[model samples]
Target: MKRLALTTASLALAAGMAFAAEHETTVRMGTEGAYPPYNFLNDSGEVDGFEIELGNELCARAELTCEWVTNEWDSIIPNLVSGNYDTIIAGMSITDERDEVIDFTQNYIPPASSAFVGTSEDADLTGGVVAAQTATIQAGYVAESGAALIEYATPEETVAAVRNGEADAVFADKDYLVPIVDASGGELMFVGEDVQLGGGVGMGLRESDTELKASFDAAITSMKEDGTLNEMILKWFGEDAATYE
Candidate 1:
């Protein structure tokens, strides 16, 4: 899930392509198969993650035949517009900028916080080098926060930027950072208060695909209403994660 917030040009292109293929029955779900717990490639090189499992369930509920497609975060929206995929099932935030280009199903995941992390607890919070994945919300925030923002193509590189002293800290989703910090064996720790950004995460569809959007919206609502959504949250993001209910 790249914070690759939506783009206007890409969204328009995607809408046009989708209109031409509106009658297609097979749904291709696009995702960044690099963000863990959201969507990522398993050791077997298959797309697997919290969003993957949840997406499969949603497809089943919608009675749609779903196929997974991996894409880079930076060009995800443009790719979707080009008919590279029919829908985006990545952990994409529902923001007005994104809404301008593509339609969204009702939020599937609740709002979540982004965390700051570094090797030392006292790492610079301002005016210091900070790293974030390119096109992500974290990168945007860092750029505006007066920090020296070094952007990378992938989340893994952002973490690498901090470890190699290219940056003093990294800004990223708390859930993504938690496992890294835990596995760092005391080499890393979170610093600074968590920053909440964007609206809840949702599935992205072509603006013209109201029927597809409605189908997924109904499925998402069913999960939230039945508590299955919250269960998936606990399973993926831990009990402390905020739930819909």
Candidate 2:
């Protein structure tokens, strides 16, 4: 899951109240179209990934017309607060700090671990320069864990830092790192213990949009009850990924 430290002003109540009137039939879903396995631009250059597929199903279940919107991770929340989108279905983790800015649906993905990947298996994680996406939970963890932290604007750049010898390791979601490591052949490998952080992944919405929130929440619960949610998780994250149980 992704967790960005938010510093923007809260959304106005007027905007939240206007949501139902302005888009009763349609919902705009904002995402960072870079993070793979969660949300990404496919070969056809359209948003396509696990979240894209699951979000469509969620919208259909809630009977709401939905459209996709792409934004930089750093500005994703601010844009939502300014009415650029109706909801955020990116790989954003549910955290108390974020809850102060926008409401979150009950977790759609269970809590997962953060991990470090480096070019070498013996990389010095405690003292080496570590790279992480700016304002992410992994970045914060790196800063406080005694490693010299380097921040990148995108997740790919963080991985690149390790490849280019600019960083000793790159820390991020273990699921996000898994495919990268596998594709690297022998170039990259996980270097440290998996660290658990954040609660889980969820949809971020304005506080006043309680009706829409309830609709989506009910849809999520229905999916959980019928086992579709678990099926989707395993489909994207493989058999070892966490589930609702």
Top candidate, metric lDDT: 2
Stretches > 4 Å off in candidate 2: 1-23
- Which residue pairs of candidate 1 clash? 14-81
Q: TM-score each candidate.
A: 0.89, 0.90
The ten-residue window of minimal lDDT in model 1 covers 1-10
- 23-65 per-residue lDDT for model 2 (tens digits): 7667999999999999999999999898999889987766678
Return the TM-score for candidate 2, rounded to 2 decimals: 0.90
